[model samples]
Target: MSEAERVPVEVAVGVLVERDAAGREGRFLLTSRPPDKVYAGYWEYPGGKVEAGETVEQALARELREELGIEIGPAHPWQTLVMDYPHARVRLNFCKVFDWTGDFQMLEGQQMAWADLPVQVKPVLPGTIPVLQWFAAERGHSGPTHLD
Candidate 1:
């Protein structure tokens, strides 16, 4: 396909799970994409697109289980951001999980870390950063879209 004709598009969702740290709450999990994949080496929220026949919640639960080996409970809509990249456009839905099970383990051989939102890292994945900042500012996923 021609470069201009190629459809550069993708859909992804991010899971925002927080925990109390040192008596202060508001921490989210981020994972590093493997060096061999697209946007690799950059830190990103763990999620993928919503596939046909599957709801957003289903996609989020599946992605979390597949990528992090954690089984998530009910998740509520957090935020949605559409981003455009050189190769594709991504519609990212950020979800918040109030409950889950299992230890946080990397099912895809990626590195996972729980950090305070609005991370200090320079330039995170375009779609994921916005939600991250929202999480940091609000200290949760459910809130108004003041920073979008």
Candidate 2:
């Protein structure tokens, strides 16, 4: 394929991090993707593409800051999904962000909902079920990259 004939595909990473408030563990946050966008009305983790000249962590932090208005600290790499959409194929590199500087909120106009393990989350997105199962298997207060 010629360079001009080839179109660039977008690579985005959606992070699924858990937090514990009070004595309850396995608290995860989910946000709905805008209806106007590609994956409209679908619930997903708040993250975006790995931009040029930026690492995965850097891109994840940048995207989270823009999406949730929170500064994430150490994040553990999780599952990766390569799906083919009608327009393009996206490489979703999921991560678990446990440590951060500030509190998390919906910076964008998207809706945010918090869920606990096993019962709180649902298979909203097609690719999210596997990740959710992985999260459910490893319910703990401590943070670790659990991708089974």
TM-score of each: 0.77, 0.73
Candidate that scores best on TM-score: 1
State in Å the error of residue 111, model 1. 0.5
Q: What is the alpha-carbon RMSD of candidate 1 to the true structure?
A: 5.3
| Candidate 2 structure quality by residue, lDDT tens digits, 96-124 | 87767776677667777776544343326
Give the Å error, residue 43, model 2. 0.6
Candidate 2 off by > 4 Å: 1-16, 19-25, 118-123, 139-148
In model 2, the worst 10-residue window by lDDT is 139-148
